[model samples]
Target chain A: MIIQVQDLVKRYGDFVAVDHLSFDVAPGEIFGLLGPNGAGKTTTIRVIMDILAPDEGEVTVLGQPPGRAKGQVGYLPEERGLYRNLKVLDTLVYLAELKGTPRGEARERGTALLERIRLEEWADRKVKDLSQGMQQRLQLVAAVIHDPEVLFLDEPFQGLDPVNVERVKSLIAEWHQAGKTIVLSSHRMNLVEVLCDRVLLINRGRSVLYGPLAQIKQAHAPHSIRVHAADLPLDLPGVIQVQPDDGAFNLTLVEGVDPKGVLRELLDRDVDLRAFEVAPVPLEDIFLAVVQDEDESEEGVNGLA
Target chain B: MDWRKVWVVARHEYLHSVRRPGFIIMTAIVPLFGILVLFVGTFFAGQASRLGDFFVEQFDSTSQRIGVVDRSGYFTPILPEYRERFLLYEGESEAETALLAEEVTTVLVIGEDYLETGRVVAVTKGSGFGSAAVSDSGSVRGFFVDHLLAGQVDPALQRRAANPMSVEPRVVSSRGESQGEGAWGFVFTFVVPYVLSIFLVMTIFISSGYLLQSVAEEKESRVVEIVVSSVRPIELMSGKVIGLGAVGLTQVMVWMLSAVGFSSGAVALLAVVGAASIPARVLILGVVYYLLGYTLYAILMAGVGALGATSQESQQLAGIFSMFAAVPYMISGFLFANPNALLARILSFFPLTAPTMMMLRLPLAEVPWIDVAGSIILLLLSIPVALWAGGKLFRVGLLIYGKRPTLKEIWLILREG
Candidate 1:
């Protein structure tokens, strides 16, 4: 593990921003921190960035304390900023120098980064003159100009149009492939599912789910099969209830039933089954289910009161 | 403690300020105005003194004629010079005719009881709409005393009888030199102190304002979030303070160097830099006080800037501190009257007021070395505490936005920080 956060807790006055939260990132893995708007994802990121101190517990990043090894960590804050009056290249070079890059090399690297982003023509232009997407691109370049070993991106693709979003996605993917340990926080679950090897989902400062992406998906998989038939017969062996999935019916089985045996029995009974499939549940469905469960539980308690 | 980061931040700030069009224009204009005021003011002052000397020389050599209508027989024998200028008239009409024909400059009419009353009136020009009282006829009185009294009284007593006694003026310097009194003392005593104090105040005010705006801009933009991730808060604040201080110092130096150039040029062409001359001690002290004063205000402004979410908020917050900064200048004039006044002495040692107060009093009075040393020590000692407080505010407030922090909340932040 390149980073370990053990029993980490952070608070904002009376509000618990990150409550006894503990998670780790394996070396060279793309880790996703998933949460809703006011969830503790951002608070956790800030603590890991060393921008905020945790109220309790410890975080060891890159084999040292967060700030002790900050030179090796690149962080893109949720709220973006750049020297608006400065040239794009100068802004990048200056930021790189702050991370301990030499001035001459920083400029050269900044130029190359701008070129890679197709912002070379706009390098000499002031940041305020650039489009918002272009400015964000420049900001990202500034973040990784020194080629840090670890990266933290907080909603890095926010405010970006689809095209710019793809551009930034490719850049992040490229960075991930280059053996840089990366932690990404965003509201876009689909993107996280595609990009992250592991994910930790937290809500109201408490962890709702955390594990390898494949394992989490497996754990959330419903024991059901989709049946497309002309007449779906009820009272089938091992069938408990049926939910709709497009034109097909999702047949839920009793806890320990064998779906293959049921399909074999159905085939023998001369049922007109056109198609039968078992698919892994979508991550989005899992996210909505867990969130809805949490809200309903709270509502139930409120109803009791 | 990271000097390289501080240096980088400072260099960035310096370049940022120096490249502005307003800074360049202001740099060019300060000394031009300073020099023009100095030379032109001295020239007019010099002209007034020369004009006074010219009037005295003309008064001594100019010729004048007088016609006297002495009804009472007081003067039997008249001197030759008096016969030419002070001739007796037969009647009032003749005297009036002689005066109107440009024959005499004045006509003196003796009163009916002139011998007993010693009363006389002289007429010449009209009584214009000015402060020319009829009783103010010094020339007529002088003629009576110098001419008429010379014959009436004994010669030895006559000279002494006209002017009984006069004061003999004397001025002694601290070096025991018998220096005569003149307005020259004002040039060093008042002008130097006034200019140096004002210069320190204006430079710090403008420079610290720039520092405040810069920090607030970074905060509002949320750029500091990324910056603080890499560098410590004090390092960033110190870099900005040191950087902007350099920019202000550069501007003031340009003004001073240009003033020196203008003074040298004036000495060559008009010979009038004397009235505007400032002592070497004042220059050195001005620079020292300016540095001290800027540090105090810069960190304070930096704290305000960090707390502010917008440029206007930062300026308004700094405005509160700036109100106190003006108190010293407003009360410094009193120190001119009594340099040892309790209020003046108290303000001299107070950090907020020390720089300007000392500059105001140092040139005017023989300020004790202990007082000067005390004020400097107090100012220097207050700086670290201010930085510590400002740094605390800066670190805690850098990330906060939209909402303004109350004093209690800020104090809480200080405690927590």
Candidate 2:
């Protein structure tokens, strides 16, 4: 584990922000911490970055405590900030230097990053003059200029246009390919599903789910399937549910039955099947299901479930 | 605290401050206004002096109109010189118009038992009454009074009473260099230090508040977080304080140089405007006191700024420190009258008021070396404490969001550390 957070707990007075959270981010993997707003995502990231101390926990980044390894880690805080009056390149270089890069190398890396972001033309422009999307891109460049062993980004995709979003996603992917550990926090489940190999779902400051993304989805086993046919009767064996609309039928198989077997049975019945696909459960559905499960469990404890 | 990182933050702050048009205007305009006021005042003063000399050279005869309401039979007797300057009138109404129309400069009204009871009255527009314009309506009134008084008094008695006793004073210093003196030296020594001290206090207070406001701007903009993440809070605060102090020092230097140049030019223009010697020790003390004073105030301002969650709050916080900075100037008014008083001594020993009060007393040579040393020691001791407290407050307050901290909360934070 390149970054390890063991039962991390942080509280403000009587309000707990992170409760007994444990996770490990392997080297060279893009890990995501998915949660809704005020779900301890930023707090977790701040803990890992050593910007805030956990009340009772151990956080080791790059084989050292967070404070000792600050320079070895790069962090892009949720609250995006840059010196508005400073030139783009200067701001990038300053951030690079802050991470222990030499001035000459910082400038070189800053210019290269600016070029990569397609903002070289704005090298001398004040950050306040840049469009919001462009400024977000600049902030990303600042974060990654030093190329730390681990990167912690919170809401890095905020304020980004689609094109720039793709640019950043690809950049994160590239960083992962280069064997750098990444822990990304976002409310956008779709983006996380596309980029993250593993995820930790947190709700109300407690982990509701944590595992490989694929395994988690497989375990959730949502009740929706895709079916395509020229004609279909209302009754069908093992077809416990069906909703026909938008020129497609969504079916749910009965207990202990394969969706593919149902499709095969439909074909054998001489039905003209155009397409048969077992619709994969989206991460969003899994997130909602897990969060709702936790809420229900709490309601059960309160005798209101 | 890494000095290099601090230097980076300092360099950035310095460049940003110097680049600001407001900062540039403040740096230049303050000294420029000082020089402009000095020039305008000196010009009017020169004009007034030249007019005085011209009046003294051109005017030879002096007179006044007096209204007398004597109801006694005794005739008045006076010296020829005194009689020549008085013009008695019969009624107050005629005297008022004559005085208004520049016909007479004065009117003397003497009522009942004029000589036996020695009752007499005189009124005049004082000196330089009608010098701007000359009229001949009351020109011979004093000459007629002199002839009438001569007919009433003995000629021998008038000459004896005309002249009276007069005395001249002398002074002796330790160096046995007794120099003739005038009110000019007293005014120069008393007023210049008081004025300069006020100027210094105002300059230091205003410049330090500018520093605080600048820090608040960066904090409000979230730039301080980025800077402090690399450099320690103490380094950042020190850099800002030092940078602004340098800017202030630059302004003071400019003002001093301009003052020197202006004075030399003024001396050449008017030979009678003597060169006032400023003691070497006073000059040295001024610089030392300015640095100490600025540092003391700057650190306090930085501490106040740390608790300020927004620019507006920071501005209001700075106002409180500005009042403290103005205390010394406020007390200097009383110092002028009693430079060596117990109050002045106590205030001069206090680090906050020491700079301005001691500076005020420097020209008078009233501040002892021990008092100066004590003030310097106290100020020096307080600076590090202030800086440390400010750094602590800044470190904790920088990341605190939402509400600005109250006094109790700030005290709690300080005690926690």
Name the top lDDT candidate: 1
- Tell me the spans in candidate 2 whose CA falls farther than 4 Å from its real position: A69-72, A118-122, A145-149, A161-164, A170-180, A229-272, A302-305, B29-93, B102-195, B256-277, B345-365
Per-residue CA lDDT of model 1 for A92-118, tens digit only, reads 888988888899999999999999999
lDDT of 1 at A288: 80
Against the hidden true structure, what lDDT does model 1 obtain? Answer: 0.79
DockQ of 1: 0.64
Q: Write the per-residue lDDT of candidate 1 for residues B236-340, one digit (tens) a residue.
A: 999999999999999888876765565455445545323344555566777888899899999999988899879898888888888877877687667668877
Pairs in steric clash, model 1:
none
DockQ category of candidate 2: acceptable
What is the Cα-based lDDT of residue B68 in candidate 1?
84
Candidate 1 chain B superposition, TM-score = 0.69
Question: B1-417, model 2: which lDDT tens digit per residue?
Answer: 666666666666666667778666756764575467556656776563353334444554443344343345233444345455554445677776677776676555556655465544544565645432323323334333444455567766543333222223333233554422333233334444445555566667766876787777777776665455445567778778877887677766665555455445444544434434333455567778888989888887877787787878988977876665566567766766777778778877777677767777776655666888888899899888887777778777777765798888888778874
C-alpha TM-scores of all predictions: 0.80, 0.78
Q: What does chain B score (TM) in every candidate?
A: 0.69, 0.73
Q: List the residue pairs that clash in candidate 2.
A: B65-B106, B65-B107, B66-B87, B66-B107, B66-B108, B67-B107, B67-B108, B67-B109, B68-B109, B68-B110
